[model samples]
Target chain A: MEIPVKTPSHSYAVTIGKGILREALTAQHDLFTKADKIIVLTDENVWTAQQSYFEANFPYIFEVHVMPAGEKCKSFENYNEVQTYLLKQKCTRKSLIIAFGGGAVGDLAGFVAATYMRGIPFIQMPTTILAHDSAVGGKTAINHELGKNMIGAFYQPEAVIFDITFLHSLSEKEVRSGMAEVIKHALISDAQWVEELLEGDHVTELPEDLLANYLAHGIQVKATIVEQDETEQSVRKYLNLGHTYGHAIEAAAGYGRVAHGEAVMIGLIFSLLLSEKFGKVNHQFTKRFLHFAMENGYPFEAVREFTFEQLTEYLLKDKKADYGQLQFVLLETIGQPFVQKVELEQCREIDRQLRALLAEV
Target chain B: MEIPVKTPSHSYAVTIGKGILREALTAQHDLFTKADKIIVLTDENVWTAQQSYFEANFPYIFEVHVMPAGEKCKSFENYNEVQTYLLKQKCTRKSLIIAFGGGAVGDLAGFVAATYMRGIPFIQMPTTILAHDSAVGGKTAINHELGKNMIGAFYQPEAVIFDITFLHSLSEKEVRSGMAEVIKHALISDAQWVEELLEGDHVTELPEDLLANYLAHGIQVKATIVEQDETEQSVRKYLNLGHTYGHAIEAAAGYGRVAHGEAVMIGLIFSLLLSEKFGKVNHQFTKRFLHFAMENGYPFEAVREFTFEQLTEYLLKDKKADYGQLQFVLLETIGQPFVQKVELEQCREIDRQLRALLAEV
Candidate 1:
């Protein structure tokens, strides 16, 4: 199936299916045919696991550059290496880049394409379920020593080609991490989807068709938010529903140690904990969500490892933080997200409450 | 005087006047008051020359990051240092960056602003005559190891404040280097302006008022083209009239050793040499322009240092070079610029002619 995204700066589509890499790319032949070259930027893990499959199915002739896996691929050093590689390969404005891994590779490759020759055409061939969210949105970045996604651009891709056959190789931890974003989409956009998920089988055990459906739904939710606010000047803040506290946890854990979506899942509960007092969300629902998260083995142990004060340092560095005020995306109820300026004092209070709740669970 | 630049991504103004840095910034009080912090990215030379004047005129408290002078400021190591500085200074998305120097400083700072937190607002405070052209359009970049501007983004600035008072402190070489771009602006836009420049006193010796007028005219020409083609997808390529060969020589000379616009002046002569054969441009006119350049001391000596063979490697690496075909911006006549795909053999012919003519002069 195909989902179209229309932003002020770009208009592209997300083509998602099982074993559709060759067909999807062939469909977008015009984007490839115009390019003087095509470069596939992947990571060691993804390339090692899926190179043969990719090579067999990728219709076009292209060169490939393998990077260190996970958040390491998003570092400033890696970002520079990719550009140097492109320069060495003589990639030009006409060159089309294929971001051929999960979120890390997508972020790094998207950013490289955005800046290479002041911008070039690129497509997202996302290999992980986590990338269902990232690859669709044009938020490309490299990490600064001080923060994640700190140095980057809102450069959209020409298309996002998600061939789910690649996801067959994901580890259990990867599946749990990827599902957090899928769950995040459900939580922010549809209460019915959230309910279905809460009562469903293990997140990693979702049937193939159901997994694709959920991924498609999550992408649609993200695409709608992104279309409304391409640069996150306004409505797009809602998409960060679980990210405020989530990113702090992720950053404090030093990235990769706590997977991005895993930390986001923890943050989802943190937002819910805050939502209880600030919005119409019930303590009962927050508790049930916590129960759901625990049963799914979302690592809440990482939270105990860092004190709120330590996490607070990273929290203040958030891109969404206006001045010193922490801006969070909190649910009025499931499916309705709003931005709120929470003081450091209230955040500390919620952090304390979250720990107490996690201890009981 | 104000020239409005209206590009699809942005709309800003070029405020050009003598000694108006204080007033120009004051007029944009809204932009200032909104920024949580202000960062001034400049070079040692510029800060030393005009720090007192800037501090006296600037209305706000700003942290200054004085970098190594010239192209050194745009190196990858320095780009990383500036980001670390901003992170240390706790600069958030609300922070505003002041690109307060010539083209190099503006390019570096503009790029920093472009990527920091996925972009922050920035203003160009040009401290030299050449910046009247560079400061206007939002072409921000850093130099890669392989090529100049191989790494960058097309990020627009909020406004470009050209305080020509800063030019009073420039050295003779800086003056000559800067006038080349102003001359280029005239060449691509107005035949009358070109004739006026040809008949005028030595470029660096023009009356202060006349210099300001010429800069303003150059900015207008640039602004118009940028409004139409901000990304160099169309008419904007005309602005790169001499940059193909100019960048080759600039890169061949290893940056800082040769002033950018000086190399451009040499490339301008090369382009005119090409136009004589390919367009209606007369050989006599090219000679007259060369004579004008000599009287103004444009340093054609830089060109003699690198042969066509030596420069060919860099020329092939030109951002505009596609699949070994050189894309040169040539004039059909004065004020009428068009893009042409010239082969290497023809480029060699032009190189020979340029050398023979330079030897005569």
Candidate 2:
């Protein structure tokens, strides 16, 4: 499946399918032909699991820079190290960077490409289901000591080549984590898509073809939203649907303690509650969504780990926070998402409602 | 005088005049009005020299961050400190950054603004004549250990406020350094402009109004080129007329030993010689230009400090370089420029010619 993404700055395609890595990469012969060198930036976990597969499929000669697995690779020190390596390698502006891991690797590599020699072309070769949404968006960043992805750029890639064959190695927890974003895409775009997902098999047990379809659908919704607002000036804020609260919990959990998508899944419930007050969303749907989440085991139990005040510390630090007020993406009904400014006092009330509801269930 | 810069990414004006800092800053009332907070990033030298004047004329409240003077402010450590400071101050994407210094400060602050929160609005308040070139172009960067400007972004500013009042504090060497780029702007765009500058008073002693006119003219030339090619893909390479050889020498001489514009002046002489060989430019004109540079005390003596072999390492690292061939921007004639690939053997021959010419003179 080839989904084209057109933004104000540039346009590229997200080519996604099972076992499509070699063919998809070959399709971008023009980008590779111009590259003076190709550097693959991946992580330890991905390299350990799929190095042979990647080596066999990727047709071009490239240098590989294996970084620490997970969020550790997104640190300032790691970012600088990668830059120093590029400088040492004499990577020119035409040197292409292959972001060949999950969201963390893509963010770090994309940002590396964005700033190296003031900017260079890079291709996103996402290896995880979670990257379906992130790989298509031009948002690339590294974590600051103060916040996650506080330092980055809206640097688009030359292309995103997704080979779902890599998904075979993802643990069950990783699948559950990745599916939260897929569910997010459904909630924000189509009511029918949301119903289908809600009634589907457990996230980890999804049939292979159905999983690919869901991932493609998610990328299309993200691409459409990104095309309309590449820099998040307006409708792009809708994509932040659960990230504001999600990032807060993820941050409050001390980063890596809770996976990103799991926190976002919990934040999704919080938005549904707020949507009930601000939009046409009803409590019944919100409850049904919560029950589905409980069945799939999204780790909402992490919510009980920190108080609202602890989470509030991270919330106010959100990029979307305006002079301390919270900005949230909430649903009007099942699909339509909108930005709404919510007060801290009201947020606390929602926290109470979420805990009570979680306790009852 | 207002010179507007229109790049594909953004459009803003360069407001240049004597003692016009306050008025120029105020003219962009919409920018300030939208900013939640204003943080001025300047070096100690600029803040100490112009703080009272800046404070008195400035129409708004702002936090000032005085960094160590010169290129030190553009280090990775300083970049991190600035991000931490902004985070501690509770700044958001709505906050504005004011880059108030020479090229180093502008590069650092512009890059800080470019990466902070994935980017924020920034205005250039350049305090030196050299900035007349750096301020208009949105090529923001910081120095990496291995190379100058290896880490950066092509982030355009909201506006540029050029107050000639700040130039009064510049040293004679600084003025000489700044005029090299002004001379370059003339060399690459208009033959008449080059003749005007060559026949004018010594760089440090030019009449105030005339200097301002020259600076404005230089900015206009830059704006025209940037409007055509914002990212230096084609016509913008013309602006790099003296930079390739200049940067190598600047690097070989250990950066601060040779001022940027002075090195560029020497590089301009080198290009003229290359132009005589490759283009229609006459040797007599090259000699005349070399005479003008020597008379202005542009430090042609610095050329004999390093051998061609010593500078070769940095030359190959040039961002415009492809594979291993050196890419140079040479004039077809004064005011007409094009890029050419020069082999190492040819480069060595030119280096010998430049040395022998510098020796005989």
Candidate 2: residue B307 Cα off by (Å): 1.5
Error of 1 at B58 (Å): 0.7
Write one digit per residue (lDDT tens) for candidate 1, span A243-286. 98999999888777899899999999999988987889999999
Q: Each model's DockQ?
A: 0.82, 0.88
Question: Any runs in candidate 2 off by more than 4 Å, and if so which?
Answer: none
TM-score of each: 0.98, 0.99
Cα distance off (Å), candidate 1, residue A120 = 1.4
Fnat by candidate, in order: 0.82, 0.86
Error of 1 at B264 (Å): 1.2
Candidate 2 interface RMSD value:
0.7
Clashes in model 1: which pairs? none
